[model samples]
Target chain A: MNKSLSMLENHPHIWRAREQSQQEERFSLGFDQLDEALNGGISTSGVIRIRTLTGIGELSLFKHVISKQRTHKMIAFVNPPGDIQAPWLATFGIDVKQVLIVKPSTEKESLWATEQCLKSTACHCVILWSNGVNTKESRRLQVAATHNDALCLLFTRPNRNSMHNSAALQTLPISLDLCLNYRQHALEVSVLKQRHGWPKDSIAIHNDWTPNNRAIKWAVEHNKVKRHVLHSVS
Target chain B: MLWAYLYFHQITLDTHEKASLSVGNNSRYDTKNEARHKRTGESANGQHQPGKTQTPAVIVYCEKTNHIVQRNNGALQQGIEIGHGLAQAGALCPQVCIIPFSEEDERLTLVQLAHRLYPFVSDIVIDTHNTLAIRLDNLVHYYGGHKELWSTITHELNLSKVSYHFATAWSIEAARILALNGVDNYECDRDNIKHRLSQCSLSLTALDKKTKEALTRVGIRHVHQLLAMPVHELGRRFDNNTISYLTALRGETFPHVTLFRPAEHFEHFTLLPFDVENTQHLTPFMEKLLGYLAHYLRARNLQTSTLCFQIDFREHPSTQLEIKSALPQSTVDSWLSLLTLRIENEVLPEPAVSITLRCDNFETIEGSNGDFFSNRFNEVAQKQLIGRLNAKLGEECTFQPKVSDTHQFETMSNAEISSSISASTFTSDIVPTFLFDTPKPLTQSTKVCFGPVRLHSEWWHETPRKRDYFIAQTLYGVRMLIFKDEDNQWWAQGLFS
Candidate 1:
């Protein structure tokens, strides 16, 4: 063996990449492609931001992440915009008993709830839907997440090009930010900000709805054929 | 063998003071004036009589007999006596102020005294009327000795300014007899109890009035004279009850003293020093009350799930506010935080003069030793956070999702955020995670991706219905559950991740 290869073989633990050093400490996002893109999966510390347009399948991504979390740990949704369809989440293999929904009426209360869930070791993952969060609140949430080793995912709607102010866009934290949108009936995930390591510009994931749609089309065509045969016999 | 009895000498007077003490710097006379002001809607400033100010002279009038029942030191110095007619007492002490006696006030004061002494002794028996008999055998050594224990008891009583007479003996009966008859302090030894009883008056023993009169007729003026007679003859002469009382007092027989047990619930009331017109003034008082409650809980190894506060106003009916915890809590800080959050939104309807705190739903904490590891610490912190949030926001706003067994889409799941829900009993792989509150109509151009599961109702309703359910995909690539009715119209039921 080469001299450096022999040295590396002697102490493999010390020579591994820093990102892969604590592999067990991180939770997989359930997508091997996304995991490889982010240098192993999401770290079970600090905060991750996912910016997307309204009604662009943010909830579906959240359900996928929630299903990947450990069954024993609780998953909290702080101030979600709409009613959470429990049956739909159950279909994605998420345990309903371990899910907590906090609907805070005000923006201030929503931020507080997010921070509390992040600081609590009882919860394994927190999905926060916040419209406009400032820099200070984001920092507080990041510290809390680090304290408990909890995965915090903040999903926000992209700033609309309406009359005037861009305060929400300007205040985005300089951390890992991913932009998700629909492209040709598939999800297009792109990395807009990366604090460390190399990240690919974009990736396309075929929607999981393809097989279900094909089955539905076959059923509909079969039903139409049976109806036509009955009509001809009459 | 060390036993102590506390006799509240003038419980009626103390009860009167208790009601007025919270009004701040107001004497018993001012309390009467305030009561009069409440009834007539008149201010107390003009109701005061001249020269009656600060004269220690005070009178307690009994309405049933229309006579003076009690008098203060100033009245005593002026030669006022009990059982005198109200007219005569008023004439004798012109500067004296009179207040009516209330039985309710006296009863509440005695209960408060019992609560105060419970920490020092566990086996306390409240004697007839205004006496509390405490068994201080093993407890005396805890305070150094009998003398030190007595001093400690007196110190506490003096701090509360309770007018009390103390007595101790080998038996509870002897101590009560000594304290009732103006023998201020005495510690009778077991060997010399007979000698001690010999000096006590015959009227002080627990004998009926008829038996006492019969003994008096026979010229028995003291306990020794009654003891000189033959036992059989005494029993035949005055009845078995008198003989039994004599035997119990002399330490020859054990008396059946009904031991007092404090109620299992916690109830503490205090008259505020000043009227609480706003909720902010109540913080200190609430903290003090919570501290006492925490002490009680620690001693009993119990935690409370619910607590209620009753605030009494001078003119309005008392208002009640209840606070509930997500879990049984014993720590003072957790309870204080919840209480502070609850009081922030409360608006006081009237100025509160007194407050009462009570809790009955107490649960015994599982482990006596709170040696919690990191995991248990986190669990407690999470519970505290949930409790605070529920208290600040409404209970309905926070919950965990509960899955139910049902074929209907929306009915399959509901929020089960309350602690009362049992652990998950059932799980289904077929149920979708999200179901719309109401099904939406689907457009004709929508594409079906899966499912032609035909479902028919068993005619349970007035109309039997058939439907074909299908998994469909919107143009936006959202997976949805759509169903076609018997009329061939389709509706979007739910979405799948």
Candidate 2:
């Protein structure tokens, strides 16, 4: 207490509180372990960049987050206009009207739209899907996303080697990896990184609204990927 | 060429039951019954003191209905109600078709057919509104006079089963009267127009009077009588409107007819069913749209100086970016390249569903000569590379100072990474350019520890951050987080960039 007082006296301005309080407007990510892994939840701080190999659930994760935020705020999808697989997002609760999709006529338009979404305070989240995001552009969006207090997510299908080679990459204080658990009729999610506390192990989520009996039976039969549960315990 | 006229053609079908059922109402028949009950004339006619033994005048009005003279086994003459008498027509023939006569479509068709016959005539105004205004003055000479022109028009109209009464006169109104009442279809002319008018009627009914008393009072009737009236007296009695009407009838004022031609706006676009994920897929389609837009622009001698790019995402919404240029060029290649550079670094978190290009900042190209030689090959290539770097690094990792005269550090804003950077490159002023990344929080000795920089944005508004900023070092001497407080207190913001 005396040391704290001394530090405060020297500074004359810094808070001496035990907990550094931040704004609380977090959303449930559906997966409890993923939420726990992301320090409470993905930081609504700024733009969040998610890099993945093709067909690695980047788009699915984005759809999931958008579904969660769309109830209270507007979510935008900036891409080239195309037929969105409506059935895929139905289980996650995203419908046609709630999603505002933009397909820019030009590449410049795509970037400009992303910038606009980040600046839009009314927008809860902005998702930009493109095959061509580079380091400098991602950083710029991150700054804009942070300033607006709107979540900006970038989807990139970066190879493992390219991900490692991206010099501008900084460890995301929060990250989650969603994988298709073959044995179970659900996705197995694990936290790849966390800033605060270690996230609990991989949790096997059964098919949407799957009964507990089926989930338990599947888990008992295929427990090989259940090492995440053990890691959380230790 | 003919009289200036307004013509309306209405076609009515006997669909009382069918129409009512189609509207989903079964009570329409009852409503019709109620309407008939409220109509007082038919029921009250005999009750009114038996009209004091007064006999209602047998009104002999030929109520005209459908006017098409159709051929039944090549027969030319047609009647209004062949199957039923006038009194029982509605009940006996409940579904008879009523087609109001149209002079416009007839005249238009005649003029079109005439144009083909008289190819020397550069233009023909189809007086479709009036039935009697077919011109023979110019065409007569082409066909060697009255007989040939009349035969041609008659034969053409007859082939289409269209019965027409033809007349010739110095004025269109005279021709109209002659066509309606003449014995010979083509014998009426300038000399007989006055004689025909005088013989027709001397009552106001001839001038289209609707009331019986008014028709009787206008004893000074006939078109000739009305036309021969003193201009001043006509004006004082009937107002100035009659002067203009008489003037049009006497051919004193000529009406200029405008040929119908489609107006062109010079704009076009292409649409796709799905968002273009691959630039390769979008490039060719964009080229086609731009090609059409360019052709339209060139045809109008105009150019687009600014263009906008818009993309709609599958999951969320749309995004738009505008690109402004100092020059205008019709080529789509440059635009595609520039746009590709901008989007080259952008990652869409969702698949794009659609894209659109909007062009604005239009201006006249000034001359027919087109000369464009400001090749931006190197600049475009550099921009593409920089965009890739920036997208990966974060948009903040690149900055071009948006210079302003302000003492506060935060107020010193920077322009975004775009073409605007090169515009300000010529100036020699000390423009402080900052890195795109956030400045890392620095750790130092704290006589005055990291502070909450008391930044009251404006006193009048909900002022943000009465921050007191600080820089504090760790015990191990490693530089660390910078902090700011609300009321001149401390909290970490970021690390030094």
**Which structure among the candidates has the greatest lDDT?**
1
Give each candidate's interface RMSD in Å. 3.7, 22.8
Which regions of candidate 1 fall more than 4 Å away from where they truly are? A1-24, A53-71, A85-95, A158-168, A184-186, A206-234, B1-378, B415-430, B443-445, B462-465
Where does candidate 2 stray beyond 4 Å? A1-24, A33-46, A52-64, A71-84, A90-92, A96-126, A129-135, A143-151, A157-164, A171-234, B1-497
Task: Give the TM-score (vs. native) of candidate 2.
Answer: 0.30
lDDT of 2: 0.45
Residues B229-277, candidate 2, lDDT per residue (tens digit)? 7778666655354566566556676645444322233322222323345
Q: Cα lDDT of model 1 overall? A: 0.70
TM-score for all predictions?
A: 0.44, 0.30
Restricting to chain A, the TM-score for each candidate equals 0.76, 0.58
lDDT of 1 by residue, B1-497 (tens): 65677788677766446445534453543554444322211234224466854545667778889878788787787688988877777666555566665556556667777877777667788775677888888787688777787777777677667787777777777787777766676564654655665788988877888988988897988978877887888766666777787776666785677777677789987655446678876766777678779878978878888999999987898989899999888877889999999999988898777788898888887764453222243557568767766877678878877755445554456674445344543544334435667777886466665667777765786777688887766666566678999888889776554
**lDDT of all predictions, in order shown?**
0.70, 0.45
Per-residue lDDT of candidate 1, residues A1-234 (tens digit): 699888887774443344444334455666678777876666656788887754445656555556765545677888765566565556556677667889888989888888877776778778888877778888788788878867788888764454265645654553467878677877878776655545566677654632345555677787775345544855
Model 2 chain B is weakest, by summed lDDT over 10 consecutive residues, at B6-15
